[model samples]
Target: MASFKIEGGHKLNGTITPQGAKNEVLQILCAVLLTPEKVIVNNVPDIIDVNKLIFILGELGVKIEKLGSNSYSFQADELKLEYLESENFKKDGSSLRGSIMIVGPLLARFGKGYIPRPGGDKIGRRRLDTHFEGFIRLGAKFRYNKEEHFYGVEADELFGTDMLLDEASVTGTANILMASVLATGTTTIYNAACEPYIQQLCKMLNAMGANITGVGSNLLVINGVDALGGCEHRVLPDMIEIGSWIGVAVMTKSELTIKDVSWDNLGQIPNVFRKLGIQFEKRGDDIYIPEQESYEIQNYIDGSVLTVADAPWPGFTPDLLSIVLVIATQAKGTVLIHQKMFESRLFFVDKLIDMGAKVILCDPHRATVIGHNFQSALKATTMTSPDIRAGISLLIAALSAKGTSTIHNIEQIDRGYENIEARLKSIGAKIERVA
Candidate 1:
C-alpha cells in the first residue's frame, strides 16, 4: 500500500481545476459498448477506477484509441465475448464495482451478459437487486451461482416494459436506462435517479440516436431503437471534486479558485458550504474563496440545529457528506450530518475524533460536530483511508492539522481523484507520495 506524507498548518493559494466527473464517465464509457461505431469521449479523468474500466474495455477487444491526454475513441465492433467466461475475466470484473455497468450494454446488444460479484469500497451494503430486477422486468432471465459468486443474464430478445425502481440508485438507473434504449418497444422507468450525471448519460444516448425523454426528472421514457451510432461527448466537470476543494480551502483558511465548476449542475453543494458560513463568490464559471479566519454554522429557521442530509438530485449529495462533516469541525457552531444513503459512511468519524475534533457519533447514520471556532487545531496523526470520500476528507483534515501526518491506503483516494499529489503541489499544498 502507498502512503501520503503531508505537512499541515500551512495555507495554500492558487487555482485548481477538477477533473471530469468520475461517476458520469463510468456510465458513459459503458455506453460505448452499446454501438459498434466509434464513440469519442473527451475530458475523461485518469483515475484508477476509470483506468481499470478502460483496461477492461481494451481486454474485451474494443477498438480503443487515445486521441489526447483526456480523450479516447472506443468501438466495440470486435469484442471478445468468449473472454467473459474466462477466469481472468472474473478476476478483472470483480476488482471494480463499475464493471457491473458493462452487463447492461452487453446484454442489450448480444443477448447475454455475465459478471462476477463486484468488489469496491467497504462503505456499506450496495445491492445489485436493482440492476438485475430491471433486466428481468425487460424479459431477460437471471441466474446466480452461489459458490462461485457469479451472476448471468440472458434473453433471446428484450422487449420494452414499464418498471419502477425500488430506490433511486444512480448506477442502477444508468444500467437499466442503457438496457432499455435498444428494447423492442418503449420503456418507462419510475423513480429513476435524475442526478446530473444520469442526465448526462441520457443526453449522450440521445446524441447517439436514442429516443429518451424526461432528462432531468425522476420519470424517464426510453423509446427503443434498432441500432445506435457513435457520437462525440464531453464529460461535465466533477461536482464531488469541486466540493472537496471547497472543504480544503475552508479548513486551511486558504484563498483558492476552483475553475469550470459548471455552476448550474452543482446542486445544493455551494449552499451546503454556505450553511457552514463559508463564504465564496461565483466568478463566471469559477468559484473563488478568499482567505478565511473563521466561519460559523447557520441554525435552521425554526432555531433548531442545522441538519445537513442527503437525498436524490436537487438535494444535497451523499458523496460530499464526509467533507461537510470535516468542514464543520472548525466552524463556530454545531451542526448535524446525516448520511442516510449508507450506514457505514459516517463510521470514519472515529478517525477524526482521534485527531482531536469534537464529534459525537450519534449512530451509524448520524454525527453531530462541535466546531472549534479557530480556537484549536487538529493534531496530526497516522491514519488509514477507509474509502474514497473519507480518504480525501482525512487528507483535508491532515492539511489543516498542526504537524506532519501520515495516511496509508491512499489507493482509495487515487480511485477517484486524478493526479492528486501533483495538483496539490501546483496549488502550494505540502503533500508527497511515499513509495
Candidate 2:
C-alpha cells in the first residue's frame, strides 16, 4: 500500500485545471463497446480505475490507440466473447464497480453479458437489483450463479419497453439506456438520472446514431436503431474535484483559481459551499476562491441550523458531502450533513473527530458538524483511507492541520485522482508520497 505524508498550514496560489470527469469516462468508455467502428474519446483521465477498464476492454479484443496524452481511439469491431467467461475476467471485473457497466453494451451488441460480482468502495450496501431489473424489463433473461457469485444476462433480441426505475441510479440508468438504444422499438425511461454525465453520454450516443431525446430531464425516450457508428466525445471537467479544490482553498486560506469547471453543470455545488460562507467568484468559466482567515456558516431563513443533504441530479451530489463535512470543521457555525445514498460514508467523520473537530454522528446516514472557525487548528494523526472521496477529504484535512499527518491506503486516492501529490505540490502544498 502507498502512503501520503502531508504537512499542514500552507497557503496555495495560482491556477489548476480539474481533471476530466471520472464517472463520465467510465460510462463513456463502456458505451464505446456498443459501436463496431472507432470511437475517439478525449479528455480521458489517467487514473488507475480508468486504466483498469481500458485494459479490460483491450483484453476483450477492443483495438485501442492513444491519440494524445488524454485522448484515445477504441474500436470494438472484433470482440472476444469467451474472454468474459475466463478466470482472468472474473478477477479483473471484480476489482472495480465500473466494470459492471460493460455488461450493458455487451448485452446490447453481442446478445450476452457476464459479470463476476463487482466490487467498489465500502461506503454502504449498493444493490445491483435496479440494473438487472432494467435488463429484465427490456426482454433479457437474467441469471445468477449462487455458487460462483456471478451475474449473466442474455437475449436473442431486445424490444424496447417502458421502465420506471426504483431510483435515479446513475450507473443503472446508463446501463439501461445502453441496452435500450439498439432494441427493436421505443423505450421510455421515467425517473431517470439526468446528471450532466448522463446527458453527455446520451449526446455522444446520439452523435453515434442512437435516437435519444429528453436530454436534461428525468424522462428519456429512445428509439431503437439498426446499428451505431463511431463518434468523437470530450468529457466534461470533474465537478467533484472542483468542489474539493474549493474546500482545500478555504481550509488553507489560499487564493486559487480552477479553470473551465463547466460552470452550468455544477448545479448546487457552489451554492452549497456558499452556505458555509465560502467566498468564491465565477469569472467567465473559472472559479476563483480568495484567501480568507475564516468563514462563517449561514443558517436558514428562520435562523435554524443549516442542513446539507444529497439528492439526485440538479441537487447537491453525494460525492461532495465528504469535502463539505471536512471543511465545516473550520467554518463558524453548525450544520447537519445527510448522505442519504450511502449509509457508511458519514462514518469517516470519526477520523476528523480524532483530529479535534466537533462532529456528532447521528446515525449511519446523518452527521452534525459544529465548526471550529479556525480558532484551533486540527492536530495531525495517522489514519487509513476507506474510500475515494473520503481519502481526498482526509487529505484536505491533513493539509490544514497543524503538524504532520500520515495517510495509509493512498491507492484509494490514486484510483480517482491523477497524480494527486504532484498536482497539489504544483500549488505549494507540502505533500510527499511514500511506498
Candidate 3:
C-alpha cells in the first residue's frame, strides 16, 4: 500500500491544469463494446479506476494501444463474452461500481450478460435495482443469484420503450443509454442524469451515429440505431478536481490559477463557493484565485446558519461535499453540510475531529462544522483513508496542518484523482509518496 507524507501550512502557488474526467472515461470505455471499430479517446485520465477498466477490456479481447500519456485507441473487434463468467473476471470486475456498466452493452450486443456484485465506496447501500429495472424495461430478463452474488441478464433482442427512472442515478442512466442505443426502436429517458459526464457519454454515442436529444436536461430522447460507428472523443475536464483545488486555494490562503476549467459546466460551484465568501476571477476558461486570509459563511435571509446540500444536476454535487466540509473548518463561521445522497458519507468527521476541528456529526448524513479561521494549524497525525472523496479531503486537511501528516491507503485516492501527488507538487505543495 502506498502512503502520502505531507508537510503542511505552505501556500500553493502557480497554475495547474485539471486532468480528464474519470466518470466520463469509464462510461465511454464501456461504450466501445457497442461497436466493432476503433475508438480513439484523448485526454483519458491515467487513474487507478481507468487502468482497472482498461485491464477488464483487455481481458475481454479488446485491442487497446497507447499513443501517448493521455491518448489511446481501443478496438473491440473480437470480444469474448464468456469472459464475464470467468473467475478472474469476477474477482477484478467486482472491484468497481463502474463495472456494472458493461452489462448493458454486453446484453444489447451479445444477448446475454453476467456480472458479480460491483464494489465501490462504502458510503452507503447503493442498490442496483434502478439499473436492472431499466434493462427490464428495455426487454431484458434479469436473474439475481444470492448464493453466487451475481446478476445475469439476457434478451434475444432489446425493444426500446420510454423509461422514467425512479431516481436520476448517474450509473443507471449510463447503463440504459448504452443498451437503448442499439435497441430496435426509440427510447425516451425522463428524469435522467444530465451531469457533464453523462452529457459527454451522450455526445460520444451521438457522434457514433446514435440519435440522442436533450444533452443537458432531465429528459433524454434516444432513437435506437442498428449499430454505432467508430468515433474519437476528448474527455471533459475533471470538475471535481477543479472544485478540490478551489478549496485548497481558499484554505491555504494561496494564489493559484486553474487552466482549461469548463466554466459553463461548473454549475453553481463558483456561486456555492461565493456563499463561503471565496471569490475568484475567470480569465477566459481559466479561474484565478488570489490570496485571501479567511472566508465567512453566509447566512440566510432570516439570519440563520446556511446549509449547503447536494441534489441532482444544477445543484451542488454530493461528491464535493467532503471537500466543502473540510474547507468549512477554516472559514470564519459555522455551516451545516447535509449529504442527502449517501447515508454514511458524513462518518469521516471523526478524522477531522481528531485533527482538532470542531465538528458535530448530526447523523449518518449530516454534519455541522465550526470554523477555526486558521487560528492554529492542525497538528499532523497518522490517518487512514476511508473512501475516495474523504481521502482527498483528508489530504487537503493534512496539507494545511502544522507538522507532517501521513495518509495511508492511498489506493482509494488513486481511484479518483490522477497523479495527485505530482499535481500538488507542481503547485508548491510539499508531498511525497512512500510505500
Taken over the whole model, the C-alpha lDDT of each candidate is 0.96, 0.95, 0.92
Please provide, for model 1 over 1-435, each residue's C-alpha lDDT reduced to its tens digit, 9 standing for 90 to 100. 899999999999999999999999999999999999999999999999999999999999999999999999999999999989999889999999999999999999999999999998888999999999999999999999999899999998999999999999999999999999999999999999999999999999999999999899999999999999999999999999999999999999999999999999998998889989999999999999999999999999998999999999889999999999999999999999999988899998999999999999999999999999979999999999999999999999999999999999999999999999999989888999997
Tell me the TM-score of model 3.
0.99
Instruction: List RMSD in Å for every model shown.
Output: 0.6, 0.6, 0.9
For residue 7, what is the lDDT in candidate 1? Answer: 96
Which residue pairs clash in candidate 3?
none
- TM-score on alpha carbons, each prediction: 0.99, 0.99, 0.99
Q: Write the per-residue lDDT of candidate 2 for residues 1-435, one digit (tens) a residue.
A: 889999998899888999999999999999999999999999999999999999999999999999999999999999999999999999999998999999999999989999999998989998999899999999999999998889999999999999899999999999999999999999999999999999999999999999999999999999999999999999999999999999899999999999999999999998999999999999999999999998999999999999999999999999999999999999999999999999999888999999999999999999999999999899999999999999999999999998999999998999999889999999999999999
For candidate 2, the 10 contiguous residues with the lowest summed lDDT are 7-16
Residue pairs clashing, model 2: none
- Could you arrange the candidates by lDDT from highest to lowest? 1, 2, 3
Q: How far is candidate 1 from the true structure (C-alpha RMSD, Å)?
A: 0.6
Error of 1 at 56 (Å): 0.7
Which structure is stronger by lDDT: 2 or 3?
A: 2
Clashing pairs in 1: none
Q: How much lDDT does candidate 3 score?
A: 0.92
